[model samples]
Each structure stands twice: as C-alpha cells, then as structure tokens.
Target: MLSIAITGANSGIGLRAAQALATAGHHVLALCRDPDRGRAALADINAHATHPAGLIEADLSIPDSIKAAADQITHTVGHLDVLINNAAVFDQTVREPRFTADGHELFWATNHLGPFLLTAHLSPLLAAADRPRVINVASKGLLSMPRIRIRFDQLDDPSWYTPTRAYYHAKLAQVMTTLSLAEKAEGHLETTCVRVPAVRLDPDRVAAMPRLLRTLYAPKNRMAVPAERLGETYARLATRAGSLPGPYVDENLRPVRAPASAYDRAARERLWSLSQTATGDPAWAW
Candidate 1:
C-alpha cells in the first residue's frame, strides 16, 4: 500500500480524504496544525481503516513547524508515495490582512509558500518512493474572477488585501507551481493540481455562522459538492496508475485548462525563483 501524507487532514476535505485512503488500506498520515484535533481525526480514521492512520502536527504557515513536521514524517514513515498540499486558511470573515511571523501575508504564506517549502523539505522522501507524486489544490472559484492576476510585488502588501483576492491569488500560484514542477521533474516524479469546486461545509459549521450569512449561504450550500466526493477524488489521484490526463484536472479527474497566466513560462519561472527565495532554497530532488 502507498504511504500518503495529507495536510489539514484533521477536518473537512482533508479528514474525509484521510478516512477514504485509510479505508482503502493505504497508510495515511494526517498532518494537522493542532495535536488534539489530529489525534481525534486519527482515531476516527483508524476506526474504519484496516491500516492505522498516523498523525504529524504541522502548522503550514509557520516555516519552523513545517520543517519539524517533515522531520517527524521522515522518522515515522521513512518514505512517502504521495504528498497532498491541502492545508489552507481562507477565513471569509476577516476584512483586514494578517501577517505571519515571517512578515508575509497569512493567506500568501499559508496557501502558497507553506506548500512550496513543505514539498521542498520532503522532496528526498518523495523521490525515494517507487512512484512519487505531488497533488496541489486550486479553486474553481477562480473561474469567477477571470481577471485576477498574481500581484508579485504586492503579494504581501496589505494595501489591496481581501480574503477572496488573497486566497485565489495564492491558489493561482499553486496552479502555476504544479505545472512548473511537472515540467522540471518530467521523468522523475508526477505532479497535478486539482481545481476544487465549491465544497459543502459541515452542518455544524454552517449553523455556527452568523445568522445573515447562514441564511444567504443556505442556497449555495445546497448546490455545493459533497466533501466525501472530493475526498475520494483525492484518494483516486494519489493511487491511480499511469499518467494523469494533464497537469490540471477537475473534480471528475478530467483534464482541464488552467488560467492563461499559468501558461506564461516566464511568469511561472519568476514565481519559482521567488518561491525558492521565500522558502530559503531547499534542496529540490528534481
């Protein structure tokens, strides 16, 4: 069975994916920011899993935490067949920008740079496996903001920061990174970016929302895709044999084109260079 690591596996899509993968008899590693939540998630996953799931406390927004988590994974699993960069912060309530300890915007750091560094740190472990694969997540919400572009110079600037803007911007970077990795690691490893559609939240979470939002979101929530469906999609991509349809795919595992910006080789290269610098230039196995 493949050894798979999924960030943000404590809840929502991540937790569901962990449950599905573990039930499939794969060794699933649930990487979460909170230890308590991780333990609870592990227990739940193990209850139905033939193979007990593992937990590694990891706060992706924090560079030190990501490093420590990678080290822990090395000791626990030795090698990883798949790494799913799924942890992301997208709080819609926050109207102001927040900064990480590293002086980067919270969304930019957590959603983009965090995954970049984590992948770099785990490159060796991934390369050691027989068929290494990396799955990056993007949002189908990007289709709504077709004009959105990566503000390279103002990525961390608070001037024009908005929750939705920051989120999609970072997601766009992730999509570009996936394509770049696929090209750079052509014969060495496999990489793909999944364009996630609007996923329905747990009923409890929706009930916890403010009354106005709860009312407004009810209709949309009904139309949102089920978390379990997307979770299985993630499991499939992690274990499916043969090459992927393309670097970018939809929830159905069908190939889909990325944003036009993702195709600009020069911009992607620039983002790569910036990401390396932001991440302290970890040794890339490719």
Candidate 2:
C-alpha cells in the first residue's frame, strides 16, 4: 500500500483525504495540531477505512514542531509516498497583526513558510519512496487580488494587510515554491500545486466569525465542493500511476498554467532565498 501523510488531517480536506486513502487501503498518517483531535480523527477514519489509519501531532506553523513531526515520521514510516501540505488558516477577521512562534506573520508562516520548511526537512524520506509526490493546496482567490505580487517587505506589515490579501500572497508563494520544487526534483520527485475549490467550513468555526463575515461566507460555502470530492482528488494525485500531473493543477487534478508572475525566474529564486533567510536554515534545499 502507498504510504501517505496529510497535514491538517483533523478536519476539512486533509481529514477527508486521509479517510479516502485509508478506505482505499493505503497506509495513512493523519497529522493534526492537537493530539486529542488527531486521535479523534484517527478513530473516525479507522471506523470507515478498511486499512488502519494513524495520527501524528504537528503544528505546522512552528518550525520545531514540524521538525519533531518529521523525525517521528522517519522513525515510524521510514518512507512516504505522498505528502500533502494541506493545513492552512484564513482568519480574515483577525484585525490584529498576529505572528507565529517563528516571528513571521501568522497567515504567511502557516500557509507558506511552514510547508516550505516541512517539505525541506522531509525531502530525504520522500526521496526514499519509489514515486514520491508533494501536493500543495492553493486557492483561486488569488486571481481576484489586484496587482498581486510577492512583497517580501510587506509580509508582516499590518498597516496594509487584510485577511484576503495575506492569504493570496501566501498561496501565490506556495505556487511558486511548488514550481521550484518540481524543477529541483525533476525525475527524482514529483511536486504539484492544486487550486482546490472552496469547501464549506464547520458550522461552529463559521459561527465564531463576525456576523457580517459569516453571512458573506455562507453563500460561497454553499457553492463549494463537498470535502469528500476534494479528498478524492487529493487521493488520486497520490495513488494514480503513470505520469505525474503538471507543476500546477486545479481542484479536478487537471493541469493549470499558473499566472505569468509566478513563472518569473528571478522572483522565484528570490522567494526561495528569502525563505532560507526567514527560516535561518542555509542548508535547507527545496
């Protein structure tokens, strides 16, 4: 069975992907931020899956936690067939400029830098697999941003930040990073970014939002694809044989040509270099 690990597996797309893979009889590692929640998710997956699923507690927003999770995976699984960097946060209403333990902006750190470091740390394990693939979950919201560009200086600038802007920048970074990884891996590993369609939020989570924000999101969520459909797409990327998908793909697993800016070689290289600076890990390679 293919061994797969999914971050943010306690809920949403990650959880559903783990369940789908487990049901398909692949060995699944469901990584969650909370131990209790991870175990609960594992139990739910076990109930539906023919093959057993497991849990690993990991807070991707923190580098130390990511390293610890990687260490545990190496000790336990040895090799990973697929790694889905699916965990992300969209706290649009968080008015204050929050920072991660790493001192980076919360959205940027969680959505981009965390995955970059996690993938870097886990590269060796991924290489050990026969057909390793890295799948990054992205969003279409990026297209709506006006003149969207990677402003390294503005990443943590709360003055000009909005929840949507920060999130778009982070996802754009992810897309570019995926391209770099695909180029670096070449024949060794397959890396792809997916622009997953919006999925409805858990009601409790939505209820916690401001009434206006909740109302704004409710109709959009209603139009979103169910978690199960998105999960199936994620599993297909992992389990399917033959040629790998393009460097960028959509929710349907079809290849997508990322925007022209994302293909800029200079910007891409600069972003990688800045990532190294942010993480303070010169030896880390995508």
Candidate 3:
C-alpha cells in the first residue's frame, strides 16, 4: 500500500480521493485545517475504509500552519510516498478581496502560495522516499482565466479577474507554479496537476457556489461530473505509472495544455521567488 498524504482531504474532491486511496489498501493521511471538521469528514470515509487513515491539522491560508502540518507528517509518520496539493478556496462571500492572517491575498495564499511552501518544506522526505509523487489539484477553469504576465509589478493583485478572476488566477498560478517547481526540482520528485473538468457534488456549499446564480437554490448542472469522478482522476494520477507527468490532465486522464501562460518558465521562477518571500522560507537549494 502507498503511504499517501493529501491536503483538503476533509471534503469535496480531496475527501473522495483520500477515501478511494484508503479503500484501496493504502495508508492515507488527510490534512485538514480543523480537526473537528476533519473528523466529521473522515467518519464517512473510515466507515467504508479498507485501511484507516490519520488526520493532520492545517490551514493553508496561513503558511506556518502548513509548516506545522508538515512537521507532524514528516517526524511523526516516518515517510511520505505521495503528497497531494489539493486544498483550494473559491466563494462568493470572499469576493471583496480578503487577506489571510499572514496578510496574503486569500485566493493566492490558499490556491498557490500555500501549496508552494508546503511542498517546498517536504522536499527532503519526498526525495528520500523510494518513489515520490506530488499531485496538485488544479482546474481546467484556468482556461477561463486571463493571461498571467507574472511581472514584478503585478503579482500583488491576483485581483485582475474581477468577480472571480482572483480565484481563477490562483488556479492558474497553481499550474504554472507546479510546472516550474517540477523543473526546478528536476531529478528529486515528480510533480503533476490534474485539471478538473467540472464537478457537481453538493453544489450549494459556499466553496462550490459561483458568483452569479440564476435561481436562489437550483443546482446548475446535474450532468456535471461528481466529486467522486474528480477524485478518480486524482487517484489515477497518484497510482498510475508516468502516464501523465508535468502536464495538465483532462477528464479522460490525458495530457492537455491548459493555457500558454501555464508554460512560462520565467514567470514560474518569479512566482517561486515571490512565494519564498510569502511563505517566509529560504530559497530552494535543490
């Protein structure tokens, strides 16, 4: 069984994928910001769990919280085989441009920078493992985002997208940043992102709701895929042989280029440097 760890594992796609991994005889470690909520989410999965999993407390909105989570996973767990960068934030309530306690733009922190720091800190453990894999949960919604120039003057505002552009840009940053880190880490680890096609599990949840709704309470698309399906794609990436590496995967689990901006190396490096500052971590040595 694979020793796998996943963030945002308490709900939505992350939860389902963690459940799937546990159900497949793997030792699953689910990272949640709050243990109370984490336990509630885990009960459903554990009830049907073929292998019980552990939960680690973390809040990606704050870098230190993620760092603390990393410490427990590394020191307490012995080793980590797979790390899924799955937690993300999107909601109409936070449309006004909020900041984490760390003062980072909420979307940027949760969607991109937080994962960057967490992945950065866990490098040694991941590299020491027999075979290490990092799966980042991105969204094909990146296709809908504006072209990210990634200039020194611009990154402070992931706000260019307007109503929801901030959130989508954060996703776009996740893709670009993942690609960049894969190259930077080169021989050390394998990093990949699964671009979510579309999903519809519990659409009324705050995180799942979009900015504009035609009706007060109507679920938009029943035809839209479910979180289980999203988890399937994530699980396939976690367990599959190098079928899709360092690229975005569609619903079919095939490679697809989300946006031209997603491939910018210079932009990636810049984001890396900035993320280093945001996370208050040392620059990458390897």
Best by TM-score: 1
- Model 1: residues >4 Å from true position, as ranges? none
Could you arrange the candidates by TM-score from highest to lowest? Answer: 1, 2, 3
Q: Model 1 over residues 100-206: C-alpha lDDT tens digits? A: 88899999999999999999999999999999999999999989877777798887899999998999999999999999998888778899999999999878779
After TM-score superposition, what is the CA distance of residue 16 in candidate 3 from its true location, in Å? Answer: 0.6
lDDT measured at residue 200 in model 2 versus the true structure, 0 to 100: 74
Give per-residue CA lDDT, model 2, range 117-234, as digits (tens). 8888888889888888899988977666646789977777777777877888899999999988887776788888888767877666788889998888889888888888898889
Full candidate order by lDDT, most accurate first: 1, 2, 3
Which residue pairs does candidate 3 place in steric collision? 33-58, 161-165
Across 126-150, the per-residue lDDT of candidate 3 in tens digits comes to: 7777778888877766676556545
**Backbone clash count, each prediction separately:** 0, 0, 2
Worst 10 residues of 3 by lDDT: 211-220
Question: Using lDDT as the measure, which candidate wins?
Answer: 1
**lDDT of each candidate versus the true structure:** 0.92, 0.85, 0.76
User: TM-score of each candidate?
Assistant: 0.98, 0.95, 0.90
Of models 1 and 3, which has the larger TM-score? Answer: 1
